[model samples]
Structures are given as structure tokens and as C-alpha cells.
Target: MPNYTLLTRQLEALLDDRDWLINAAQTCAFIMQQVPELNWAGFYLQRQPELLTLGPFQGKPACNPIPFSKGVCGGAARSRQTQRIDDVHAIADHIACDAASNSELVVPILRQGTLWGVLDLDSPRHGRFDEVDQAGIEALVEVFNARTDLPDFLSSH
Candidate 1:
């Protein structure tokens, strides 16, 4: 298990740039660097209705424009809830951007009750994430949200 307490403090310190784009990029890099066994760490920005466009990420090439009705990222966006899967292969609609990714954790990013996007983390090992990880990552995300001035992308919705 990671030292989430320390990770949280580090994230807060690293987020010196409050710009959403910069923060997103830094957050992805931080997760990939600090977390072990992660194959992918990134963000899926909901620029359009019911769709998530690829944002800053660290990994191999990825799938673009995931719909809210499809995949784990979509499920998190559609439901506005965190989705932590022990085995991505078991998900019938799992979007296999990386065949090596066996597990996934996606947290919805909301601004003023409106959807902004999602923070997605994928791992090559099955069951790589547990409740502790979920809570820790969620807290880290809270730090992102608190520090960054994320635009209300869906304000017009």
C-alpha cells in the first residue's frame, strides 16, 4: 500500500499551478510515478454531453471519445460515482485501450454539482486496487479539486 497521507501532502505541494490543464497533467504524472503497477493514469474530460474526451495522460495511446453509456469511465461519468473494478476483463463493455490493463479505478470529477470529467487509473495486475486505494485516491482527487480552478464544463447543460 502507498503512503496516501504523504501522497496527499505531496500532491498539495505539487499543485502550484491552479490551471485545470496543468493540474490535470501533473496529477496524471504524479499518479503514474507514485503508484506502483499502474499501466495508465489519466483524465477523461467531458467536453460534450454524454461523452468523455481524452485529456492529459501517461501511458500508451488510448481510446478517444468514450460515451457515457460505455466502458468504466463512462459508467463513472454517467452515474457520477467512483468505479473501481478488480478485473477489467470481466466487464463486458470494457474499452480495451491497453490489453495489458487488468484493473481500473475511475473517479468522477464534478464542479458545483456539474460533471467536469473523470480521473482514470488502470493497472496491469488484477485486483490491484482495494477500498483503501479507492479512499486514498478519492482524497487525492479532492486535493486536486480544492486547489485547481476547474472550469464548469457542463454549466450550460
Candidate 2:
């Protein structure tokens, strides 16, 4: 695994730019580059209480406007917890934005105790994400949550 300490530092520096969209985009791009076996890395911001709109992502086209009621991403958002599936295919309702993805890790992003959004990472290889990854990604999500200003994307309703 790459050095998460270094990665986190780099993330902090990038976030110094303070343009949420650009920083979010850089976060996706940076993780995709550092992590191995990952085919997709991205964010889905809560546009409303029941919907998540796609943000910066690195991969093939992904599912946009994910509802709060469905899929792994939805599960994380609704529960405000991380979802790390060893085999996404086993989940009866797994949303296959990329058919190649066999495993996934979705971490919910919270800001001031509110459901902000999620950082979703996918891999073509099963058992791709483990505890180490969960820890690292959770740290990354902390960086994102602390630095990002998300009101620009969320809706009042």
C-alpha cells in the first residue's frame, strides 16, 4: 500500500486551494492514482434528502442521481456508515455502475453531523478492500469532510 500519511499530507495541500469542486476532483484523481486494483474512485454529493448527484470521479461513466433507498452508496448514506463489500455480486441489489467491479468500499461523509455525501471506490478484483484500506479511506474522508464546503451542491428541500 502507498503511504497514507504522505497521501493525507498531499490531500491537505491540494485542499489548500479551497475551491471545493476542484479539490473534490483532485481527491478522486489522487486516490485512483495511488491505490492499486481500483477501477473507479469518486464522490456523490447529497443534492437532496433522497438523492445523490455525481461529483468528481475517475473511471468510466458512473451512475448519477442515486436515490437514498438503493444500492451500496445508498446504504452508506442512509446509515451514515461505511460499506465494504468483498463481492458486490453477492449483494442482491448492488448497482453495477461498472460491470467490472467485483468489490467496493463506500464511506459516508459527514459535516457538522449532517449527511453530506460519500466517497465511493470500486475494484474489478474481489476482496480488494480490507481493514487497512478502510482505515486509510476513512482518514481521507475526514480530510474531505473537514475541508469541503458542500452547500453549493445540496438542495434545501
Candidate with top TM-score is 1
Q: Give one digit per residue, the lDDT tens place, for model 2 in 104-142.
A: 999998877887789999999999999989999999888
- Those runs of model 1 whose alpha carbons end farther than 4 Å from true positions after fitting are 155-157
Error of 2 at 27 (Å): 0.2
For 44-77, candidate 1 gives per-residue lDDT tens digits of: 9988889999999999999999999999999999
The per-residue C-alpha lDDT of model 2 at residue 95 equals 87
Q: Considering only N, C-alpha and C atoms within 3 Å, which residue pairs clash in candidate 1?
A: none
How far out, in Å, is residue 39 in model 2?
A: 0.6
Best by lDDT: 1
lDDT, model 1: 0.94
Please give the RMSD to the true structure for each candidate, in Å: 1.2, 1.3
